[model samples]
Target: MRTKNFVLILLSSLSVLTFLDRNAISIAGHRITEELHLSESQFGWILTAFTLSYGLLEIPMGLWGDRSGEKRIITRIVATWSLLTALTGLATGFVSLFATRFIFGAGEAGAYPNTAIAIRKWFPLQERAKAQAFVWMASRLGGALAPLLIVPLQMQFGWRVTFFVLGGVGLAWVLVWHRLYPSESPLQDNTDQQQYVAPENDAPRWTVHLKDRNFWFLLVMYYCYACGVFFFISWLPKYLQAGRMIAEKDLSYSAALPFLLAAGGCLLGGWLSDHLVSRIGLNWGRKLVPVVGLSLSALLMLGCVAVDSNVAAVIMLALGLATMDVTAPVSWAIAIELAGKASGAVTGAMNTAGLLGGTIASLGVGYLISWTGSYDVPLIILAIQLLIGAFFASQLKVSTPRALDKT
Candidate 1:
């Protein structure tokens, strides 16, 4: 097998473990809340703790990957987060859980940004979006699997044991990755890989992106989009149970449906974007998916809120996430296109914005639920954010990264 394909498989596997570990808390949220005797507002703070630290550290970790190399940095990231994931099972109160999740966020920071750097290194420009799709698809698969796997395990062995099992799974991946990742550059066909060197005097500074209007637009768009995404990640299970009156036994299937469809969305979006790019051009090809997808997703989210039947609400919510995710890979591809050699730092900045959005969603949803006495209010707010994101997506003006222009 080709080395790049092998590396992609490894990275995709890591993406699976990343979301599985990340989503476990949300899956086990009810039990955790009950056992800890935490209020909804406190629960929101716990979730926010992760996003806050994750956002704060994203750029630094991404810059670390760009300056050094992804292999070592990603290894450190997985190990630290895996250890923290296990330690989360030990928390006795709200403060302990909050601290563990915050530190876990720091450990998990830059994972995707580093993955973006690796994709830029190993895949040709045309293949990058598909590669990103596979990775993201795996993440959705992980999210889907969380309730399926965690519910049963936590029921049998307890939620804490479920986390221990997840932590062990991640550590095993770390060992496999260390052994399998290519020791040298894998692809010679990609000009970007061969031509871009980090130390060149004209190599674009990370700060240079600050001057680009497109960068700000990308950041804002992702910021708004992430609120929708993180709502699924951090709040969906609780919402399904408490807000929608989904029975506990049925939680796994109901919660898994959106992510299952979202996995497909990633694949469809990647293929559609690549095909569009071939038919037209990069600017429109990339822009079209997010604009159309997010608009539709927003409407569907409102439908989820408006529906009276539980089954109809579930379908609408599932479709909403699926449509929103259709833009995920193409958005990452745009970041890669914009940054080239600085892909790590640029994607990091974009994701920092995303995590900040997630931070707000995680905390705000809890408050909204408490204040409004319904989950509908938070969903409405998120849908509005998606509409704004679609507007920003439409406004993005694509240009070659300064680093690539120099080359």
Candidate 2:
């Protein structure tokens, strides 16, 4: 295989490992909650701990990736998170599990931003959305497979054992990543003394990103997007089992359904986004998909409440998730287009916004359940956020990164 394609595969594999470790908890939540004797609200806090730390640390770690290199930073990230994933299995109570998840989130913070850097470095501008789609599809694949894999494993061995096994998988990937991935460093060997400039020539001052109005627009848009989509990541399974009262034997398959459709959405969205960009133009091509997709997602989220059958509701919710995901590649592509050489930092900022949204959704779902004893209220709130996101998506304009323009 070609070198870049191989690297893409490795990056995709890393994305899989990352999602697998992250999603395992949700699938196994019933066992964990029962074993630990956690209330729904407390369980929400556990999920929030991961996302809260993940959001807060994304910029620093993404900046580090830009300055240092993905080779070093990714290795450390995988290793640290792997250790924490194992430690998660060892948690004897609420506080310990929450702490482990928080640290794990910190370690995993910059993963996608760094993946953006790798995509920018390896692929041409036109191909970025497709490459990003490929990477994100891997993420959905991991999420889709988690319930299918974890449920059976948890039944056989227990949630703790399942976590330990997942942790080992990450460590194995780190060893492979260290050996196979080429240098992402912009610096040349010291003996030759020739400078290896980053894509924008030199890295721009971080303040440039801070002051850009477009950056804030994209961040808020992403925040809205994250709030809606993360519902599946952290709480969907529990919602199905607890809220919808799905049978344990069938819960894994039903939970896997949304992520499976979402995986297809990423691929379709990526291909369509690239086609639109090539055929029409960036403004229409890049911006329109997200607006349309998010709007549909919003409608579907609301539709879920009207359905009476548990099976029908699950399908509607799955479609809602799938439609929302269709915009993901476009969002990431804009981050690259807007940031250029600072793709890592820019993507990081966007992801940080999204994770903060995730954090809120995580905690809010629990509180809403506690307050009203119904999942319908939380679903309605998320639907409104999706509509708000669609408006923000419409406002985004694709252009050269300010840093690149200055140079």
Best by lDDT: 1
| lDDT per model vs. reference | 0.90, 0.86
* Model 1: colliding residue pairs: none
**Best TM-score among the predictions, by candidate number:** 1
Residue 209 lDDT, candidate 1, scale 0-100 = 75
TM-score for candidate 2: 0.94
Expressed as tens digits, the lDDT of each residue in 14-113 for candidate 1 is 9999999989999999999999999999999999999999999999999999988899999999999999999999999998999999999999999999
Question: RMSD in Å for candidate 1, one decimal?
Answer: 2.5
**Cα lDDT for residue 130, candidate 1:** 90
lDDT of 2 by residue, 1-407 (tens): 27778989999999888888989888888899999999999999999999999999999999999899878899999999998998899999899999999999998889999889888777766788899899888888988999999999989998899889988989999999999998743222222323322234354665586777778888988999899878999998898998898988898889999999998888888889999988998777888888988899989988888888988898898899888998888899988888877888899999999999999999999999998999899999999999999898898777655434353
- At residue 181, give the lDDT of candidate 2: 95
